[model samples]
Target: MTTVSPLVAAFRQASYPVGGHGRKNIQVLKEALHEFDDKLESDIYGTGESIEGFQAEMAAYVGKEKAVFFPSGTMAQQIALRIWCDEKGKRKVAYHPLSHLEIHEEDGLKELHQIESLLLGERDRLIRLEEILALNDEIACLLIELPQREIGGVLPPYEELEAISAHCRANGIKLHLDGARLYEVLPYYQKSAAELCALFDSVYISFYKGIGGVAGAILAGDEGFTAKSKVWKRRHGGDLISLYPYYLSASYYFKQREPKMGQYYKEAVELASLYNSCEHVATLPLVPVTNMFHVHISVPKEKLEPILVALYAETGVGLIHYLRESSEGVCSFEVSIGDAFAQIPKELLKRTFERMANMLQ
Candidate 1:
């Protein structure tokens, strides 16, 4: 395990830390496990009601005809791409240069499916309609991550999405959504999950992100697509003895927090404003479009660590302690708003930022 620095340790001990719901632990699993006792013997592999029912419920939520649960988004997405590539007879797909498959997956799609990825757009921006216009049907699918998290959780305008969708549909190109944080972007789009997902041919959503679940994913699409995914899932050995624990937690938290997305977005904008007020600190997007944004500080991580440690000690409210050096003499980190943000007293939060402004100056 990567050891957290003293700054992170101080933030952990702070009276109010402003990021995420809380430590992801067994409590998250317990939060949704009230109904299930140990004697549920009917559940075998994924035949349980929780697992099957969640897949159906999420299918409706995301406006798909059918859905299947996956142990991980990596497994689900690779299968989604493989299905598309097989149907289109092209072993190639396209997505952002910094796509999870491209950077984070250790070439799972390439090694497992023999599928090639045509990386689209610059490293620091959303893939534009023009980029899609330049591609032919040679690529089997195009994956768009809502609120491109790497670029500060930024999203392209809805109109741009419409144009891209139209072009992809007209070109025999399947559109896949990497919607790990799909629920987080709902407030900014001012659209329902179903409406937003309508633009994509297939969608993958994470339960652990903004939903505060234990861990799981849903791959949803038309009947034919999802049926194929189920076959691929079995081929990939995703069928565990029972996934009811993950399913129940995902369903529980989705109900608990889906409605709170707007509130989280409001908190994110407010939080970003406070960061912008501090010298040497800025949030990408200037204003957050969703419940998350990247915090970039114009100070080296080495120098900023002690300052934040001191701040956490002096102020009861912890602002931020984790830091990632974005460039020379600069550092960055991501913040996602949830239950913890509301727990921080408003007056203390304001005072903490005021102290931060002074310290950064």
Candidate 2:
């Protein structure tokens, strides 16, 4: 391991105390609470409060007839898949090999639902429409991530997305979107969340991604689908007696921060373009289509961690993350831009990277 630099050490110690992960909006939250307490005090935990109001708002936002909130995306998605499998009488779901379904969710699809995943798509690219069309008969539903995350937020083209969705519809295969960062992609795609979501039978969105909710996910679809999902939610142990805090946080963020997604997308492209100009920084897909991009640093293995620690310490700017090894000494990592990154001085980001690169050399 290489030694940590003093610059990196200083960066880590500087803390933006209020900001949490995923670009939180503290001001919006405060306002939401004041309103919640004033009009929603006794109805907290969804007892007498209008749960349907939130659901209806989410459904409208995503262009669906109904929406259901889950404590977590994991539960919401699993239940979505389970419902699809039951309805279609097929026990297979097709998704990218790197999708949250296969990578993040611990085989619960198999263990809990006994459904098999027909994984497609290469490690570094979008899953092709042909891939889904070929397996159209076997798959009960096709789960598509807008920008595939594991490979650094690569998105399929709109035409390709429409083609795949059409294939699924033509074959009677349900389409479910694993849109954890759906808000991030809308700005880049020049489409509204509802417009993008209209292609699928069910769409799931996270309140904590670009929208800045503390933690919660909404699964949107038709009224019938949501009604069925409630049953699945109960079966999977996701139903809560009260979801007030989650709703409070989710509604707070959704109303305040969701509109800023376009700004985040615009900033991400500029950020990626800046890094693309750097000599040592090579991007995964060459350009970011959403608010997330990964930078591959060609530095010695032993030097990587020290540089990361150093960078975090010096400028309090979180940069690229090396999740795993790449070919040669180069390590690839992601840069997920959010509200904090929005507030960060561009010169500071530039300086941090410049210093780190000099350290490596």
Candidate 3:
């Protein structure tokens, strides 16, 4: 039922793909388990070393009173909103139009919990502070996705984030951060994880996203808030009998890649700059705020596909996996810098982009 575009098809065939830390193969999981003990006891019903210990570590990492691991961000985030709605005696929550809850989750929030969504701001832009200020809706929570993914991974100014957090607190609105790619933004903001988290009432971060782990997410908040989450976790069947693999990979990569975010950020700027210099090609934001940006090409998908295929074949540098049409004939695809970018040869990169420019012209 799933289809792969020619761009992705070619990118997959390229030997020098310029994205991701590495192949998401058995090797990735193998590296994470390299130091882990085989005789270690696995967690049961969310207890023991792998589960609870990692939860506590993450709680400290994000400067929260408590944290709980979940099988997916979807389950963790829905539970977060449900708890706030119950406490505030409201069933409606607010977030950007492109929020994962609104666009991706297929109405799980509405169907499962009877919670309604009050969408804020337009789809093509980040939610402005003024939009939150004008909100007269009696919503229980306001979710802000840092570096909103759907819109080229753009972030609001840090001052705006502070103001939004203050406004939410003053008005009794629980501000939730959909920080799926939280660590990726820290370098741009020049702030610590705890400092950024202090502004929000609840935070949900993913391990498989920018961290490049197998798969898992953690929801962090005050002890009281987290206690309520555990109850909902059981109700949602989020607790597997054992999830040591996800935990191990998450912990290993979190330690391995957390310090490299600054380097990735710099590489993203460099990559975006090269992308913008190509004829008929540009990047959203004109530069990157984090390790990701959208490469927009002023060409239709049908015509662009062959160019990318040839580009990958000739240069062996697969820049992106797919294309998404914006309006008329313009199309785009996202690029997130990771360990692979640094491994690419500098001379090869120059010829790759230069050839890409010449080809597009």
Clashes of each: 0, 8, 0
Pairs that clash in candidate 1:
none
Candidate 3 or 2, higher TM-score: 3
Steric clash count of candidate 3: 0
Q: Candidate 2's error at 311, in angstroms?
A: 4.6
- The C-alpha stretches of model 2 lying farther than 4 A from their native spots are 1-11, 15-35, 38-47, 308-328
TM-score of predicted structure 3: 0.97
lDDT of each: 0.90, 0.76, 0.91
lDDT of 3 at 93: 97
Q: What does the lDDT come to for candidate 2?
A: 0.76
- Order the candidates by lDDT, highest first: 3, 1, 2
Work out the TM-score per prediction: 0.97, 0.88, 0.97
lDDT over C-alpha atoms for residue 189 of model 2:
80
Model 1 agreement with the true structure over 1-361: per-residue lDDT tens digits: 9998898789888989898997777977876787667665544676777577778899999999999988899999999999999999999999999999999999999999999999998998888789888878999999999989999999999999999899999999999999999999999999999999999999999999999888889999999999899888888999788777777788888999999999999999999999998988889989999999999899888888888898888886776767888899999999999998999889889999998888877
Greater TM-score among 1 and 2 belongs to 1
In candidate 2, what residue range of length 10 has the lowest lDDT sum? 15-24
Q: Where in model 3 is the C-alpha error above 4 Å?
A: 1-6
On a 0 to 1 TM-score scale, where does candidate 1 land against the true structure?
A: 0.97
> What is the C-alpha lDDT profile of model 3 across 1-361, one tens digit per residue?
7888777788988877787887899888998888788888989988897788899999998999999999999999999999999999999999999999998999999999999999899999998889998764399999999889988899999999999988988898999999999999999999999999999999999999889999999999999999999899999998788888898899999999989999999999998888888889888878899999888899998888898899998888888887788878998888888889988898999899999888788
